[model samples]
Target: MSRFEKLSHVIWHCQYHIFWVPKYRYRILTGAVANEVYRCIQIYCGRLGCEIVELNVQPDHVHLLVKVPPKRSISEVLGAVKGRTAIRIFKQFSNLRKKPYWGNSFWAKGYCVDTVGMDAEMVRKYVKYQEQLEKQQEQLQF
Candidate 1:
């Protein structure tokens, strides 16, 4: 295969799992707060030139399935998404302050990311079913 063909044929996809503490996992991601965070993430991901295929925003954590260009490093892509979102979230929702919501940070220290295979259909299915899996877990909890 030609170099251009080789490059064009390759596709890189990743799933990122991120967490945030509500001053210690207090579950502060409610209606408005969650919405704001989601919006910020959308913009941040767009700016980073990554496509957010799916997102599951829970009360304490978030799951994102993103497709990034092969030229971008995983760490750089995650940093852009996480860093920009954190800043925008803190700015838009001041209640995240310690005096209001929490003091120090919006997201936790680290994130989980994994690579997905080139099977596009499988990736699509995984993203689509993520919410159902969460619901099943919730049902089992009670």
Candidate 2:
């Protein structure tokens, strides 16, 4: 009946709209790379007990709306997602690691995040809409 989550000590509803780009903002997150990124994020979120409301992986950056529990800091969630995704990306796509320019990193140093208190639906639609727009643009390019 309630969107709030219950912990042993608190009832909370924490959602974040997070965005981050690849190192150097490279446009390499296409095709298999994008798929892998999604898989990695899902797994990491599940492991951390976070709920993903929406996610989109563009060629340069990622858009995620997640419901994180109060016990976890946003930085902690971001670190886990970024760190795990990077390691898996390098392992699965070994060519990326071979590139000297990548310089031992998959994501950049910082990310942008904002809390979603009331406009949750709006943000969710925005994420999905962006993905659709991206697909349409891709079709026109081909």
Candidate 3:
């Protein structure tokens, strides 16, 4: 079932599959760091009134299936998610800065974003599935 946002004059369900990697695509996200990243993302998204349908933090990247309000653009939502999570993760994991690759950033410069259409559940399952696919196989349409 889909839970939509109801504004004064409209009701909408906008879901997106977002994925991003660590700086330089390093596989630094694991153990405590991975858990903290997941927690920070959930907290940040919750603060924005966004629902995280599914989330997976791989060793080198992260994925999230989220439902956001129509009033906010994808960039705005991503900024909130990425920007805030970076701050939280950095603060909680100060040792990350010691690594040359990580430096002053936790996430890379850009991310992948795709809208979900009528079959939202299908997309959620796709996000939840653990098996990694080749880059070409991951090219999905909304």
Candidate 4:
């Protein structure tokens, strides 16, 4: 049997982080945008057969921690999330639909993803605390 054929019993948790285009910057990622992204993420995860443990939408990027079944690949899950969010964002924001919000691409090609083991508490905490950390960094800039 091939690896694809193997019936592995795995509960995989993954984190996906992706950024926006350069000129658009993080400014476009407001509370409204974040809420839309969050809603879209939930719907997309359901469609992809993944369980979203948590999600944090920052100014520059989005952090999603999801639990995927063994049959699913990490890349597949992230791609779904990114693709759906981008489409929804562009549709909702007419300005984004105009030239140059994404520069032909709604999201940067590269992303960061990490696999978590049984010890998922740390990862969960980090995801939950991401916004707080960003706020602290912003305060320090003053």
Per-residue lDDT over 36-127 for candidate 1, one digit per residue giving the tens place of the 0 to 100 score: 76787788777777677787777877777776666777778767766776677778766566355445566666677777554788878988
| Candidate 4 structure quality by residue, lDDT tens digits, 70-114 | 666777777777777888888887687677446656777757676
Q: Given candidate 1, what's the lDDT at residue 130?
A: 100
TM-score for all models, in order of appearance: 0.63, 0.81, 0.77, 0.64
Clashing pairs in 2: none
Pairs of residues at least 3 apart in sequence or in different chains that clash in candidate 3: none
lDDT on C-alpha atoms for all candidate structures: 0.67, 0.95, 0.84, 0.68
Cα error, candidate 2, residue 122 (Å): 15
Off by over 4 Å in 4: 1-25, 99-101, 119-142
Each model's Cα RMSD: 14.5, 15.5, 12.3, 15.6
Residue 33 lDDT in candidate 3: 85
What would the TM-score be for candidate 4 when compared with the true structure?
0.64
Clashes of each: 3, 0, 0, 0
Find the candidate with the highest TM-score and give its number.
2
lDDT, candidate 4, residue 37?
A: 78
Better of 2 and 4 by TM-score: 2
TM-score (C-alpha) between model 1 and the true structure: 0.63
- Model 3 error, position 127 (Å): 28
Task: State the lDDT of candidate 3 residue by residue for 30-134, as single tens digits.
Answer: 999889889988998888888899999999999999988877788888888888888887888777777777766778899999988767788777876634554
